[model samples]
Target: MTMEVQFEKSFYPISSWNQGSQPYLASILFCQGRRTTSLSDIDLFAHFCAAAVPNLAMVESVDDEKIANRLDRVVASIGRKPLRVLVQVNTSGEESKSGVDPSGCVELAKHVKLGCPNLEFSGLMTIGMLDYTSTPENFKTLSRCRTEVCQALGITEEQCELSMGMSADFELAIEMGSTNVRIGSTIFGPREYPKKEAN
Candidate 1:
């Protein structure tokens, strides 16, 4: 099991969560949501590293070089190994989603592999359209991107993971060669968001 921790103040602290589940967890995934700038927040990265879970960070934009550089610095300063990075591709082309365009996913993955020595280029991920039934196209797009990325990097599929699917479509994702799936709601039920205060 991999835990998806939203790097926000309201979620239960990662350290506490890790203590109970570390042995069972494959990795701790830090999802930045639409807040791409949060990826550069060194304190957040440090907080996660402290938990000692194998870390995976999701990037929702195409500017991988900047994100990778920031992550490298943060990990290095804390004496932690670089976090595995996933390039989130906008497979559905929805205005509400966060990710690089599908057309640019290979380029971003290649950038992380070659340009960011401090980071491990783990793989590609995509949050499909809201409709659960429409996930196959997104999975196929990610699979194709992964194949192209692996070919370009001269590495086998095992070297890179495909982080597609969530609670709803994980079974289908696994059938289509997904190495990682985020299934928080299915296991824990829907999350309660902190209410916003008036400005």
Candidate 2:
């Protein structure tokens, strides 16, 4: 199997390619909803081509405080140069969820842009709280949250990228003005269950 296929098999969706010692491109390779593991170095920039290929990367399970901390680190390491950073906010009102309060993300964005002049504050990314059955309330909550976050960051609606839909709610998200929709099950079919550990 090709490296791309191997990546797909091991991580399901996250894709990265390295040609020789140069990094080619890095896009969001995989997403496991709200709670997800952080990407590896290869996933971040090992084989990335920022100019040729879109090196899209996202923060896993983001919160205002965490965003602030990460922004500080990025600024320190990369210095004050505009860097594209996609902030993923998980807006599930459950303890098991992986994001911060939607409104709170605005504060995080502001801090990144103002405090970390190096980061361009590209847009907002989010996964709706998982619900067995879809509801208007679910979409409504995500829509409202997106709007609030954009407002907090003082970003124009056109500039704000709303990433709040997946295979289950892609249509809903599009209808609700989702800029990016992550499709998984639709393209790959249902996933197999991994072995579970006993308590």
Candidate 3:
């Protein structure tokens, strides 16, 4: 099976790609569509690729050429099949977010398109500011990146998905043309972050 998950209209993706997520993939595959963003663990990336779900996932935290190139090599060695990827854009301009800046987005996307043969330059994704709803500015920034990438790559806007929004702002995101939204929390409840230990 190819990494065939498509971020089609109203795509609802689960947000869990940790080591513990493997067993659940069997059941999750029954959904019409599924995706996992915030895939930040570079080390686990190769491990997942070599596992069972490699053909059913997309990496969304790819901000630089280094990470994209690394994925290319990993996929090349694993099965030489094309893996889908979304160029993460730091539209909020927050230092803590893991994504490419608005200015360099097109350049990085170009690398993914022409440079990474084992990868499919699928679309663009972003995390809005944690404290706020999906701001039009953030949506606009990602939309602009998508437009630029489509124009530069000779692809249509529809072909380049805009994976913005979450459960909190999915309606607004869909209104603003977000093809994909992460809504796992809405179904499963808020995440339980581990408590920090005292020093």
- Predicted structure 3: clash tally: 1
The TM-score that candidate 2 achieves is 0.59
Query: Which TM-score value belongs to model 3?
Result: 0.72
- The weakest ten consecutive residues by lDDT in model 1 span 18-27
- Model 1 scores a C-alpha lDDT of 0.60
Expressed as tens digits, the lDDT of each residue in 76-113 for candidate 3 is 88885698888889999999887889999999999999
For residues 48-159, could you state the per-residue lDDT of candidate 2 as single tens digits?
A: 1111122223332334655556655655575444455555565566666655566566777677667765456656666666772543455566567657767777777666
In order, how many clashes per candidate? 0, 9, 1
Please provide, for model 1 over 121-191, each residue's C-alpha lDDT reduced to its tens digit, 9 standing for 90 to 100. 77777778898666999889888988888888899887776777676676666667766656556544677
By lDDT, rank the candidates, best first: 3, 1, 2
Candidate 2 local Cα displacement, residue 55, angstroms: 7.6
Instruction: Give the least accurate 10-residue stretch of model 3, judged by summed lDDT.
Output: 20-29
Q: What local lDDT score does residue 20 receive in model 3, on the 0 to 100 scale? A: 16
Residue 66 C-alpha lDDT in model 3: 89
| Ranking 1 against 2 by TM-score, winner | 1
